[model samples]
Target: MSMNTLPRIEGPHADGADPAGWCDATRAYLPQSTWTGLFPGGSATSAAKALLDMQMLLPGEEGRFTRRFSRAVPGRPRLYGINVDRVMVYKAG
Candidate 1:
């Protein structure tokens, strides 16, 4: 696919944000035939639900996931923030 036709994915950030909305936005950029393949056995909403459920079982961690686009001019790269999941920990001495 050409750079102009590349697909973009994003996640919810605000309180009460709908997860399905994020999936819908991503699905909009993809071809209809690829939707099923991209989100096998389920729609975007179902996929998001499954992911959230799985994340719940994992240990708390913090980090930033970054993405960069191919530069045409060969200079400083641009970084895109994908998602940030922060877990707070309080330790008492």
Candidate 2:
């Protein structure tokens, strides 16, 4: 993607206070994880990296936010309800 086409947006925790907005891009991204299921797992460092890379916004139910993007894994999408994990969401927008 071009420099202007990059989706440089992120959403902070609902209870978070500091404006975790991206202050830099070129050196910001998602954290690295190691492979446990399908792919290797990675660290939750992206949230921090994104803090300085992408513009931080408040978390929302839907829409393009950091949760929608960062929470995305190899196959799984979101985990709703109790501790039950989920692969795809059926909620309507």
Candidate 3:
């Protein structure tokens, strides 16, 4: 979906808040495929860019990751410093 059609993000605070929390809050509004597409390159920079471009993340949010955020691969599940499967993974600190 285009940025114009995406959900309206309120407040910079919410946009730059916890990634997982934002994902959970937006789950009802966004499709899982949207999140999946955000990390096409499995790099934290790219993923953050996608989110920034989409207005899901604000500028400088990309630097929050201690490691690159990886996408899910065969026989491997995504990690976001939490116990969840098929989610993005990165060390946000």
Candidate 4:
């Protein structure tokens, strides 16, 4: 599966955020299966550029990308959402 970032609600850490929570949440929901090693896709910047290329930003316009936690833990701030850009390939046999 190919991974990509999904639109998220703006939060405090709008610039950058850890993806551990998102990964954990996804793994939890996904069915258990035998998996193979992960392969590199490309840099986030390249992905971002591809997104931007789809549209024309105003001169000097800047775009922002953020990845936040997928869920909240007790006493911890809700700082994450969903990220769709994380692609995973596995074999089931």
The candidate that wins on TM-score is 3
Superposed on all Cα atoms, the candidates' RMSDs to the truth, in angstroms, are: 16.0, 17.1, 14.3, 12.2
Residue pairs in clash, model 4: 3-85, 3-86, 3-87, 4-84, 4-85, 4-86, 5-85, 68-80, 69-80
Minimal lDDT window, size 10, model 4: 28-37
Better of 2 and 3 by lDDT: 3
Model 2 per-residue lDDT tens digits across residues 42-77: 523344334223333233245422343244223223
Candidate 1, superposed: residue stretches over 4 Å from native: 1-28, 48-93
Off by over 4 Å in 2: 1-3, 6-41, 45-57, 62-93
Tens digit per residue, CA lDDT, model 1, 6-93:
3334332444422221212212222223434556765744644453454411221243212232332123133222122311111121
- How many clashes (backbone atoms < 3 Å, residues ≥3 apart in a chain or on different chains) does model 3 have? 1
lDDT of 3 by residue, 2-72 (tens): 33443333423332333322122322122234445545556655765555454445333245422222222
Error of 2 at 13 (Å): 30
Ranking by lDDT: 3, 1, 4, 2
* Prediction-by-prediction clash tally: 0, 13, 1, 9
Q: In model 4, which regions exceed 4 Å deviation?
A: 1-42, 51-62, 67-93
